[model samples]
Target: MTSRLKRTLLALSLAISLPAGAANYSIGTGSQSGTYYPLGGMLAKVWSDNIENFNMRAEVTAASVENIIKVSSGQQLVGIAMGDSVASAIQGQAPFRKPLDVAVLFALYPNVVQFIVPADSSINTIADLKGKKISVGAPGSGTRVGSTAILEALGIHQGDFKAQSLNYTATTNALANGQIDAGVIIGSAGVGAITELALTRDIRILSFSQAELAKVHAALPAYSGMEIPAETYSKVTAFTAPAVWNVLVVKKDLDPALATQMLETAFGNMDKISKVIADAKNATVDNMDKLQGVPLHASSQAFLTKMKGQ
Candidate 1:
């Protein structure tokens, strides 16, 4: 072969052997009906659009608990998990027997606990859920974890009510159809399922008094207080509820540079994200430090340090 031809062939061989770019990644999000699904789609779109050769997508799952398990087990590169679920997984608790090998990216927004009851139901308080049919979110969702904890915090046990394991859409359907007297939902303030139910069925969002809030705090310290605005649902005035932070998380072993890149890309375009999901507006660098229990990923920590110095 001629010297020029030989050199050209060698260059082609090397180029073929090199990777195209970062590996394609999947983010585990909640059911198609939940906020996480849409938000995850926007995040995936942003990353894929801005970064060269970035092949990323969002996979809908059971949310929180399942997302955490998937991310910790390397089944997913990242996911949206409730702060409380992250704490439990790290502490080797019920949902997770061992600590999850995951780290935080940032806090997304508050997962406000909404207890929706039919307008004519006699049930009025958290305690009144006893002996009633209630939907406490799907089994593997973070909503389920929070619902269970909040019930327990109020001294209500699993045996207290006829609990149905249904997703947000199912919960709303059941509530509206009178299949369930009450349904507990932990989601954004304007979750669609609840809103749709309100338009047809007179709905009431149960609230907690100061004393009830104290009891909840004693059991789950990660939760703080939040209120649902008066007009959020039909016939439901503003009321106090338990709130937990929703955080973005990734596998602990993710490449540091890649992890940092992911964080920067997501937060740098927060405005775009918020347009898709209103709750994402709360995702800020300042809120990143507010995450509890779960430690920040090494690269995430480094990125924050660099951000602070600027």
Candidate 2:
């Protein structure tokens, strides 16, 4: 074969082997029992089913902190995290020794700081937590960081409140067994565990009223104010609480086309996701700006902005 013809044929063959320009991606989410896991699975299904060349898959791995490590290592194309946690990852704040390379796609919704006590415990306020055994949050999860910060801000340090780093399920069990004074979980109000616990026992979501939220934001400016809707859980009739945004994060260097395709699919099929997890109904183009933790990915920003304009 002539050299020129051979080169042309090789190029054609390579192009043929490719998926006509589709970029498959994976999203790293949290544990199976947590909200992130199911949400990730739904996104993956919608993306693979609708977006061309986008065969996205979701992995139920460790939450935020570990997600940052996975995405930075190029092992995952996307991740879900609390906005504050994202700030810590990129800025190399506590829990992370060095900065990471990650960017934001969009903000889904608020992940509130929920501390469920036994409903009969003596602890009634943040101050009441003093010298009491509290499950701050799961290790490496964003809740842990917020729990620590809130406690410290209230003048309750590690010594002030006994810290037990436990996941939502474990902490739930502990709270019911009277083994722990309080359990901390950072997620949307009516989150699986928190909602169920509320149904079984009267649980109250600790409020960091205007004064308390102000104190917290002063230290970690990344938190954007959030309001927990009325009657989010079964037992509780109404409670509006302050919270931070939970964001969809991705590797900074991801292919632009893939990012665009993924966002297109996600916003396109949000209704389907809403069926499984009703809270996801809030995931829309308008709310995406809530993710200021990292700069918006160009492709996602463009798609979402254009959708907003329409």
Candidate 3:
């Protein structure tokens, strides 16, 4: 065969073997016990089921910090991250060594800073946590960063507490088995582990006083004040806490059209997601601006603008 003909045949063979216009994507979400994984799974289902020639999968990761690293490195096509972490990733702040290029898709929900203790435990305030066994959060998780920052801001250094780095499920199990005195979980108001723990054992959700919250704002201005209603948990009444927006982000180089399509698909079926995870109901186009730090993906910004005009 002629050299040019052989080359043409090889190219044709390759094209024939590949699925035409097929795209495969992976979404990095938190551990299985957290809301991000389930919600991401739902989105993956939507994308796979609805978008022709598109295949997506949800990966259970170490949560926000890991998700950010994966998506920024292009190991994952998409990820859910805390607003502060997104900012931190871009600025090459603590927990991130070098600056990462990522773009925001939309703000999904608020990750409330939940300081939980046994209902009967005497740890009433952040100050009461001194010298106590506390699960700051798992290593490489955004919760860890926030927990450290908040504690340091309140003048409670790492040495002040018997710090245990555990994930949401592990934290819940540790607290319930009497292995830990307190745990900090930054997630949707009624995170799964907390709700499950409250079902069998009384749990106390600690609220930050206004002064404490002000200090949090100073330490991480990305966090905003949030309130968890009395009915959200079993034994806890209303509580005031700090929260940061949880945003969907993509690789900075992702195709704008695909980003916009993914946004529309996820938000369009949000009602389905909310039925399973109530926190997901908070996802809406109007709240897109809640995403700060990283700039919105160009396509997402254009989509939001188009939504606003309608």
lDDT of 1: 0.87
Quickly count the clashes in candidate 2: 0
Runs in model 1 deviating more than 4 A are 1-22
**What ordering of candidates by lDDT runs from best to worst?**
3, 1, 2
Error of 2 at 223 (Å): 2.7
| Tens digits of lDDT, candidate 2, 236-307 | 645545578888888888789777877877887898899997778878888887666478878877887788
How high is each candidate's TM-score? Answer: 0.91, 0.87, 0.91
Candidate 2 overall lDDT versus native: 0.79
Cα misplacement distance, residue 130 of candidate 3 (Å): 1.2
Off by over 4 Å in 2: 1-25, 224-230
**Candidate achieving higher TM-score, 2 or 3:** 3
- Ten contiguous residues minimizing lDDT sum, candidate 2: 234-243
Alpha carbon deviation, residue 253, candidate 1 (Å): 2.3
Residue pairs with backbone atoms closer than 3 Å in model 1 (clashes): none
lDDT tens digits by residue: candidate 1, 1-310 = 8999999999999778645865688888998877899999999999888877677799989999999998988888889989899988888798898987788977888889999898788999888999999999998999999999889988899998999999999999888888998998898898877877888878889999889898888899988888778987766789899898998888778888888788889889999888878989898887886766679889878878888899
